[model samples]
Target chain A: MWDYTDKVKELFLHPKNAGDLENPDAVGEVGSIVCGDALKLSLQVDKESGKITDARFKTFGCASAIASSTALTELIKGKTLDEALKVTNNEIAEYLGGLPREKMHCSVMGQEALEAAVAHYRGEKPPEVEEGTIVCQCYGITDTKLKRVIKENDLHTVDDVTNFTKAGGGCGSCIPDIEKILKDLWDGKVAAESAKPGRKLTNIQKIAMIQEVIETEVRPLLEKDGGDVELVDVDRSKVIVSLRGSCTGCLMADVTLKNIEKKLKEHVSEDIIVEIE
Target chain B: MKIVYLDNNATTRVADEVREAMLPFFSDLYGNPSSMHTFGGQVHRKIEVARAQVAALINADPEEIIFTSCGTESDNSAIMGCLNSMPEKRHVITTRVEHPAVLNFCKTIGKRGYRVTLLPVDKLGRLDLDELDKAVTDDTAVVSIMYANNESGVIFPMGDIVNIVKSRGVLLHTDAVQVAGKIPVDVKKQPVDLVSLSGHKMHAAKGVGALYIKRGTRFSPYIIGGHQESGRRGGTENVASIIGFGKSAELAGNHLSAGNSKLIELRDKLEFGLSETCPEARTNGDTENRLPNTLNISFEYVEGEAILLRLNEFNICASSGSACTSGSLEPSHVLRAMGVPYTAIHGSIRFSLSRYTTDDDINKVLDVMPGIIKELRELSPFVK
Candidate 1:
């Protein structure tokens, strides 16, 4: 049903590096059995040369998933960590001759494991992805990862994002977020990048843009820190604000106030300053 | 490659006799039944004979049988037909495990300010009759339920459903596409208002289906054109398929009466062998009340798509609820509605048999399945 190539079938039937390394130099684990597929990739590298000596995987998934992990191990063998890091999921599917379109996420699982494993090889933690907003909770896909994937792949639809990263593929409660990310990438790519921040604006246009910046960018962070902010009034080059909840009496109130001011100036206009009423 | 097809519930191999009956209609008897000439009139007579045959299968009058394109059309016509007839009723009741034909249709109608109540089923895929009794109110328009589940082959107690619904004076429709031929379905014995059946499921050609509206049921046309099907359905009839369906329905009647020991035996053999040999393999659904031809099994620690692909190596045909198989992220809705555990849901595989299934087919599946399960389990992180 998956339209898997014979090479994929060959790799899946008799995976070359099917078991885990007992004392591997690096390990990468991505996905979960709960999501219906998971992959654990382990690598043994020559410490002096930084070349991968052996690569192995333990996968729980469909044919394409197993094939993807197996293809990943074969692709990275004898390659340096830097060289292996450049191998993408698309390349893994291509090396298998081809995989089904829907199974592209399996290849992504491989790429994620490879990245995590390479980070481990460097004695560094796999970059924790919770820094930004999570756009897809089903697979824990963050806004940062979502934007990077969209721009890299020129993805135009939520379904395209789903195929690449398994985002918006389950529960679908985050589809609005994925769609927002998609909208940002779809239109924001050409507009936001090319549009200069200091473009001339009427008082009304500047006020609307300031409000958009506050609601979209500034509010979420404040909410997470047990505080909330609202714009009481906006005058020419001066924004009046009220900080509610824990922020009203916090020891770091001045820091939080400057943070909001710096954010508004950087994102909206450098001339604008914040004042508490 | 020798294929052992156990996906009959998806579709059936057309019977040899049915094909033979349709040959003449496609070539020499290509006269349009709507024509006035003697050649065309004879074709109309044959269509009548076919209608009678289809009616006889369900014990309905020939006039009451309205032929349509397929089972989905029949289901749409029945449910939509009722709503169109009585615009005041705002609610439609159905089960959570219905085929997408009825479920999706209700969803669209729900968007149009219609309330849809999806009654839940037990872990065994059995609907609670008491819930149905309470859900029907003055606002309820139509209650649509399937005769037998396509995936599990578990039969619903339609008689009890009919009794409860009819007592409330509400209209009832049963989507009998999976049950009409595989089991006995006599509309005359029950007070049901409507029933739908597909030709292809009963070994007839595709592109043909029929709906039986018990005479005197409030009715309207869903197609809304031409006088074909007595103005109930539009467009010219699919002549060859209708005739083939008639011939197939007659054969199915005889086949049903004679019993389905081979189907039951082969189904049991396959179910028993796989569950016994494959460790952690278990069957889903109620084994006793299901159709004789269906056996759904799950191999714990091994996902379904892998098992199916491994089975494909031996040219064995089947289907699974694995997310990878359907390109969706969840298992089968039927299994989920029945509260099947998450551990087993992804690994569920459905092997539906037919009269065409042979002992050799069962043996081939049994021969290859354990190895397939073992091989996938070996690669699985959950297994070892």
Candidate 2:
């Protein structure tokens, strides 16, 4: 069992504001059954006094989440609109004593529902997203902005992009696009850096240099053993090279490629993608 | 906040008097009972006294008791020893809901080319005695059934089982680990050949238990070494724990009537409060035939782990479905044998009372439980 605080227990056992409000001015729903928790909150707004006359909630979650909703409802009821707006998720957690760290998201959900209800009362729209062409379709990331953000954040991998912008964190169908975007940003940075007087070849220029080196130096050595080398493609700094002829079905093909990929990556960038097929 | 421990069937806190009895053996009286000296002789005498005390609790001969490590070891020894005594007789009979100690051992022995018959239980956790009678054959070597289920606390009809086995000239072994100290047991009156008891199930310390082997019954030693437990089980004696077990047994015998009534009352109160407060919650097993201190309830829609975690917030300790609580993926074999629905299986909680449980403790649980269950149910995915 998770170590629960005394306050969390207090609120869970004796929840302050549970159930539903009759004929509420605004209703806010957050989460869903699939997410494992949901909350339906209602508020009675006192328009003349610009205050919340009553607040109630029906929450579906573990003890902490339900307690958070209950405490959030209790904290906002009978308070003015401005006072209710100050009720944060942290404040809800504190009111319920304290919540588990993983369950902090539940408290956030409660706060979101409260804010949504208050926004509904004021006839306000949800915060808008500026129009941009979609890039990472998994999380609906926009290409025009996410590319800039990727560059600004110096993202390098699919995971880094996801963490920074929630791009590949969803279905992961757009992971290849996220990877391509990260590669483009990295290549652009390298190109800009190497264009200076003292700097050298960019990643693309470096891959071309290695391909030339493989054709002249590495391929002839492998051809002597009845084998040949072929360059596939380079994404970012990773060079994809293939082994042909006898090397294709040889037992030592792995050993030959290991030797070649190692030498090429050592002389060039370390992020080379060397595969047999 | 004060902690409320309601998971007594898992294990009980050692009683003060039992602890006191064990204290001396840990220091001044520390001697090998098998050693030949006044120091050892005193320890040997205490061992005898403990033997008699344990025997008296079960109404068996002091000579019949052979101390072993724990209930599991006792069970393994009984089942294996019986099989060894009659190597040609391969058939073994047991109930579906027997503790893993017996069930697993029987399974292992079954793999070794023995024919084993598992008797099924009804919804209330009671075995069909008629079925048991038919399952036993002339070649049956042993009939091993548990006195009470560890999870459901449903007491088995040992008297009927014993009579059936005795008429067929088959040996009977009862894993009385759950029932030994919680209720009265008399091996002589029950006409069982073997019975297993664990000290920790009572208020004694862990690592010490005993198996009762009826006099004139054929048996063999599972553990072999230099003479200890009359060469039945071979190991250096666990003196302090043995003394504690004896003391616990004595106390259990004396307080059986009052302790049972007190525990039952508290259990009923908690069960009543839970059923009244939480809709669609019902007790598992037969209410009247269950162990006095145990109440297993299945709360609809909510999972047992979620409920236990919530109850932990209040410093209230309880047990859940045997599978979830024990880190097994499968639900309890006992509950499954009873044909309990899967919808209710995941939410089952076992609240076991002890002699230490008080009315105030029950009230505190009752007061806090409703809100917890209601809140959890609201969040439950299956709640409609």
Candidate 3:
């Protein structure tokens, strides 16, 4: 019981665009039998117009994996190769009324097969087979692919990276490396834009800016730990807030507050001070 | 749709006689066995009868049986009990294919600075006795192994294991949850220190299990509570389920020899039918040395969850070792430890039968399984 949607079940039972195309323009293969899921995408491309006249997939995986391949084939047909390349893994998941978080790697596999197929058609090296520093030795996932999927899916935690790209799901020896990558990405995003220094913001603008940063950056991390923070008031450089839910009366509240203040300083302003109400 | 359940190793249907034996205790006989009054005191006598019935299934004395909540508690009690009693011994030996109850506990203890040696199995899921002989040391506290694997149905050489571990002057515990009623488990023939048994694996009710601690063994209680189970385990007893377990044991013992022959016939028929129709399918484990009513077959190319779902459409219930079925990213550890190929591991299906399984059930599974595997293989990318 994966809690699969009706659309997923319907597509899995009677998948559209199944099997391989006879003498196709290009064939793309992604994943391997050892990984428990793989897909082979075949395309019929019109040579003059560069439009995909037909697309079919032969997949080896579970219900969600089969449904994802079906959705990918359906999404790519009747479009130019460039337009087909723009379809994200998220859209394949959305076409099936969303997939389980653990099975998101299936959607990622579908997207990878599409890219590999187009790369083959264009006489370029298939990106799926391109070599890089392997982060997950079990699945052969590379650091470059990990960073790309993390950015594309807005993945915040190492668990999310595993769900999307299967980077740290086996043996778990690379989790520290994944943590460092996440930290580097977060730090890079904050350091790239630091409120343009000395742009004096009005009281209302500062409040709204802090609120936006907290919602976008701080809240997601806190919610993962079963806690919440609400902005109460802004007084000059000091910002007041209330810790709610599991955050209240927790022994790690001080550490959490320090982290929050650090995030506020990195994203909002240097003089920003956080105080608990 | 008529349901054909081949997942008996997961759990079995409660027998009619066992259910009838349990119904009285839920209301009319709802009396604490420890009460001082005669009405409640009468219930105590019935529990002792159950203790004798369970003891009779295995060739242990009635006093050796310590009723626990379930098989997991019995396993935990045996391992933690032995470790706590012998604080000086820090090393333990076990196999890689044990049930999670024992494997996970050993892993937790390993993190806590205890030495654990997990013996590896060969491709046929057979233990290397020479490796076991060398692994045992004076510092070893206990050696725990399962009687038969749940997923593969591969039976280890428990008789040889008992001799090897016992000769080392160390305690040995066997998780016999899958073997007690399905096969003969005679404590007299092979005297192990502890044996854990589950009721629901037989035709008994859930929530009731028994652990046999051989007399004069160093032991400590895992759950310390109110004075019960002779202070080895303490809690108010699960009265109804225990009674059902007693009745099921009685029934199992009554027809053990006769029922096994019939089970073997049906299991072989189902295994033969599937293998004949799908020549690419291969049976896993040491088929010659497995349980009579268990068959674990693997089909290449197709994923197991996809095949199982298609089988479900025909109301044919079975179990699989696929990563998708268990919410893990890898197939079963049992299959993995045996070096089963990834091409087949993801498609492994286990069908465990029981005495109640009829010819029609086996026929139903045989008739529909080939079609399901064939359909899934067509959709697989690896299929040529």
Candidate 4:
């Protein structure tokens, strides 16, 4: 009951080119039994044209892993080595319509195997293989690869990184390390946000902006309606204010309240909510 | 496609007799058992009959049977109730391969500052009783073990476990969810303090179960709500499910006394056929000491979920202990605790039979299973 797409089920139940190639141009493998998913991918590259003539794969994994591997093998065949290398894990997952979020690492596994196989075909070192700092011991994911997955997938949380790179998915001992890394990454973003204009503002900047909007846009408009407001406090997204003068117990106080809320949202932040104290 | 179900350990079909017994309670005899009027008095009498019926299956007195919602509730009530009754005892002992109902609860208790000792099992899923003897200390409140494993269907030596735990003056509880109807589970023979059994594991409905609390055992109610179940359990009785459970117990008692020869014969034929055709396939548990109606096998180099999907194509229902099938990154804890090789662990399949299993069901599995293995093995990288 993993909610696998029809395409994923079809590929899993009947995988195309599911076998091991002997005496092939090159071969690659990623994952292991301990990681709960492993794949052995082989390529039959046309040496003269530098094109992949055929591809075969054997995977030991769940439904989505097998389906993703099968789809990757099918997607890369009859294409040039460069074109095949350009196939992303997201593209492979998309080829199968979709996969469950937690099973997205199976698609990442397909990407790793493809990179390793293409590197083997070219007689170069397999790029980004886990010789770097190990971050996730359970899945053998490294810091360098994990960072790239996070950046490319726009992952902001530990759970997001687990889905994209399989880091912290097993034993969960590395979850603190993953959280530290995410905190570091977001810390850098917070600093960059201070410099970037018209981007998401810092917390202090948001507070200042809220106060300025209330002083310039809200107070003048309320004073014109024979009602005045005073800013009381700003609690995260909430802007607390006190009704003074004619605004106190006024019949149209609700209308003024609605006007203040709408103006704050437009000028300062869309999530701002105004409340009369 | 006609289905051949071999996953009776997971859940059984509601028997016709059980269903028949349950129907009147859902409509005409719908009075609450706690009421005082004649309409309700008749329903209360039926509940008393049910208590006797459930107790008769295990040779316990009617007062010893405390009806609960499910196996998990019965287990929780047994372990947590024991801990509550003896708040001074700071230790608990259990085997490494108990169902999550007990295993996870023990883990939570460990987090709550209680010491827990998990005894290991051998490669054939047999316990070393000496380890159990040594692990028990004066602080131990209860040693909860299972009479039979659900994943591998390996039967544990209850007599030895009981003697060892009871000798130390520690309470002995057995999660007999898998062994109750499949084999003889009479409380009259074993002097264990508590035993938990599920109605669904037998042929009754899913919502009802019973716990056997020895007459002199110290206890506390898990749900401390009402004065129902003789102050042992709370809430209104699940009238229809309780009735179905009673009828299923009577039928299960009949099956046990008459001997489940048909079940054993079909199971043996299926096991022999699979073992003869495929040399790589090996059974996981002790062949002689395991349940007569269960067979767990692992075909090396072929993964379990793929094999299950293929078997499902043939309208055959079974279960696997493989990591992929369970959505966990690791395979079954029972298989892992027994030190089963990782190569075969990913491919393990469990086929559990029942009295309803027929020779034709055995024939379909034997005919189609070998080809599925061959097809998957052909695609496997390790097979070559």
Candidate 5:
């Protein structure tokens, strides 16, 4: 059994507003059968009052999706259109207790549908279109939103963007887009840093400085912890490092290496490689 | 909240009498049955008694019983033991819908240069005996068939199958896990070379089962270790669970006739109520040939998981063909092999009754079923 919360189980057992509205003002559909879940939501918005008078939904998915849809309907019913637009996916999940981490997308889908329905009712185009050109094809995320996310979250790699927005993880077709976005952010950061005095250095000089820092600062600390690190070849500003001794088999080796890399990047160049052998 | 358990075909609650019979072996009677001391000798004698108890239920000799870990292990031992005994024989026969325990083993042996023919079943889950006869050849080593399917509860004609295989001088193994306690099975009357039963399927504990190897049948030990099980299956005895199984077998023999009729009546009542209340509902397997306590039905349009969730609200426990495999989106392989239509595949539910299930339990399920099905169907995309 998946350790479902009591609220999730209650909503699954007796889901409120679980049928299609007869005369809905707007119908919002999201997800698909191939994606493992789908939803069909209908809303009855009062034209003069700009308020949602009724909301109903039909979900074809697992417990989390069903519960999220049920809660989403209850959250928006009898609420003004402006208030409905302010509802977030986190709020939806919290309404039905907390959803499992992997199932957080279920609540996110509810928020997406609600936004789409409200957008349709107000005769305004969906905000996702006005956001900008899509940077991640897997999730259809726009470049402007991705840039804002990268700046706000301080993401440095393609994988970082994937962890934040689930952009480059699926099929890896959007990897180049993720890389371009990361490089753009890094270049912008580097330009800002170089504008200050005593921070600018050539690429080759930066690599040498990083290597010296690892051997002096990083290697001594690792050796004290009964481990050793060897520097491998550096290519295209990516340093490869191989761990030895106790670190070779330890579960914490990856974490330790990542922390050292983060430190080296801060002191040296942000684009410098700190390879572990 | 009361938790009702209706998934008896999956497993059963251990009876109190059986548990009491096993307590002594776990505590004061802990001894190695193979040792030469008086303590070991007494424990060995108790094992003999258990063998006799198991044999009496199946109408076989005590010497013919071989203790195994579980039904799947018993199945593997029987199938592999027969193949090892007749190394020259290359062909094996089995059904398409046998449990993965048997089906996967057959597939594994097939990869090792053996000819395996998987026989098909009708829409009602009955095999064509004539097709079985045609599949047999001079190179056939053994024909292993299940006595009753776990999913559909449809009983195969093991007697006729035994006659066919025995006439050909080929060995036959029948997996009687589902039918062992629910129905009467006498190995002396049924012409089979081997039969398998699990204790947990009855009112005994898990981790213990018995395989009946008919006297004079040629076989080899699948598990090679100590001289236990007459050098056939070698391992330390699972003393407590084996004793519990012995007590369960005895109780099963005494109540076999009465339990069958009463269980069938309750199962029929539940089946009729569901079909009458829900529109376009129908049974999945053969009515007359199924286990008395098992009922499989497909409620049109509504998915099984949605129905199960609604039933859970009322604390009415049961299982579904599709709901059990929730993470995976594929329909059941058994239903697909039986050629069940795609429209009805996701909507199937299996309600398996046991001796413990009462009339009130069936009535409670019947009371909540119609409203649950109607509500789910209204939300279903397939419902017209």
Candidate 6:
């Protein structure tokens, strides 16, 4: 059985805004009966104020899918179209206290429907059906959607891509394609970093930027867990750090190091590597 | 809340008699049957008695039964054992709707340079005998098919399969885990080369199964260890589970006719009642040839996991072939092989009754199922 949270169970049993809205400004539908889950989202928008007054959905899916649709509608109501568009699939999953990893595609479906609805409101082509090569034949997932989902979720593996987007989950013939896409994505990230405007940084400037990133980005997150990181040295692209407080000798210290390295890579140089002192 | 369980195809409640028979082995009789001393070695006699009881249920000789860990092991052993004995033969044949135990093993073997032919089933989940006949070749090592599908409860024509594979001069194996207890299986009457049976499916405890290798069938042991089962299956026996399996098999053989009648009555009641109450519901298998205790029905528009959750609210337990329930992106391969419409496939629910199921249990399902399906359908966008 799925380890559904109580909030998910409560919402699934008695979902809010479960019916289609009458004469809505925009309607977005995604998935299909063949896919074993589908959702039709309707929004009642106040055009003058550019705000969504109401949101409703009719879904054909499992408990998690229904709960995800309900969460999507509840999260988007009373927000502007732009604000609603910013509601990521992760936020919808977080709203449900997190969905099972395999069922993450349900949240993705919810987000897709919302995007489709907003695009419809703007009288534009739905982002999902945009021109792209079809990669997953079973699910009809396209390469564009796969790339976007991979970037949004920071997905590194084909299995993670399947869980998030239902790509490479069926027949699995597109596994090689998914693997190529992931390789290209991370590889392109490194290439783009090299080609970035600030590829060359003075040693003093690089050290200052690293300290600033740790103080502003990495340290706060560590501080939340009653741990900290102190910069020990910066040799070339390598940033040596010492763990403090609860972080020293912690089992998750390696994971913490990876997080610090990821932060440095994002804010400083892509070649930044964090090592424990 | 009184629990109503209708997922017998998945597993069953260990019978009271089977449990009681096994209790002594866990404590007072905790001795290795291979030990030299009488206190430890005498338990081998009880194990032999168990071997006899399990053989009697299938009408095979006691020496033919080789105990294994579970049905999956029995299946793996039957196929791998056959292939190992006949290394020159590189082909295997099976049905697409088989349980993953056989299907996945075949797929893995296929990657290892073995030619595997997966026969397709019709819309009713029945195989074409002509296709099976054509798939067998001189290089075919073994043709392993299930006696009954776990999801649809559709019985294969094992008698016909035996004749076809036998005439083709190839080994035939049947995974009879689901059919062994619910249906009467007389090995003498329908002579197949190998047959697999699981204990838990027949009200025995889990972790014990038996594979019957007919006399004069050349085979190799899948598990190699201490000389056990007369050098067929090795490793120390799962003592308590084997004892329980023996008791359950003996009890199953005695109660087959009466229990089947009760199961059929309750199953038909649930089927007929659901059809009457729920509109646009369709059954998913060969209705005429299906097992008496199993019903696979699909409700239109509503998804099965939602219905199952609603059933959970009423303390009813059932299972679904819907993709969401199984954590897959597609409905059951059995339903897909049967060509069930997508509109109904997501809503497929499999309710398998056992001898313990009562008319009142059927009534609880009938009483509450319509309201749940109706509510979910109301929430479904597919509903017109």
What DockQ, between 0 and 1, does each candidate earn? 0.25, 0.06, 0.36, 0.20, 0.09, 0.34
lDDT of 5 by residue, B202-231 (tens): 989999999999999998987789999998
Q: By summed lDDT, which 10 consecutive residues of candidate 5 chain A come out lowest?
A: A29-38
A1-277 per-residue lDDT for model 6 (tens digits): 9999998999999999999887999999999888888999999999799999999999999999999999999999999999999999999999999999989999999999999999999999998789999999989999999999999999988779999988887888898899899979896776475443365889998898889889977897777555799999999998999999657655568878998999888878899888989
Instruction: Give the lDDT of residue B104 in candidate 5.
Output: 76
Winning candidate number (lDDT): 6
Provide the TM-score, chain A, model 5: 0.63
The sequence of per-residue lDDT tens digits that candidate 4 reaches over residues A1-277 is 4788999889888889898777789898887876667888999999888888889998877778889988999899999989988898889889999888878888988988988898888888886564679988877788889887887677888878988777886777998899888868776776464432467878788778777777866787666544678888888888888998657755467877888889777777778888988
Report each candidate's C-alpha RMSD, comma-separated, in the order given. 11.8, 14.8, 6.9, 10.9, 10.9, 10.2
lDDT of 2 by residue, B129-218 (tens): 999999988889999999999889999888888888899888999999999878899886798999999999899999999999999889
Tell how far residue B36 is off in model 2, in angstroms.
0.8
Off by over 4 Å in 4: A187-277
Which docking category, incorrect, acceptable, medium or high, applies to candidate 4? Answer: incorrect
Residue B207 deviation, candidate 5, in Å? 1.2
Question: Per-residue lDDT for A197 in model 6?
Answer: 37
Per-candidate TM equals: 0.85, 0.62, 0.87, 0.86, 0.71, 0.87
Which lDDT tens digits does candidate 3 get at residues B167-253? 889999999999888888898899999999999999999899999999999999988897788889988899999989988888888
Model 6 segments beyond 4 Å from truth? A189-277, B257-259
In candidate 2, stretches whose alpha carbon ends up further than 4 angstroms from where it belongs are A1-277, B257-259
Clash totals for all models, in order? 0, 2, 0, 0, 9, 0
Q: Candidate 6: global Cα-lDDT?
A: 0.91
lDDT of 5 by residue, A1-277 (tens): 4457999998887789988889889877775432335577899988888889999988765677789999999999888988987887778889988876546667777877787777776677854566588766645677886776567557776656654455664556777777787777787777575432355767676667667767866887677555778767667668788888546645466677786778677667576545555
Candidate 6 Cα deviation (angstroms), residue A5: 0.8
lDDT per residue as tens, model 6, B18-100:
99999999999999988888987778888989999999999999999999999999999999899989889999999999998
- Measured on C-alpha atoms, candidate 4 has an lDDT of 0.86
| Chain A TM-score, each candidate | 0.67, 0.51, 0.70, 0.69, 0.63, 0.68
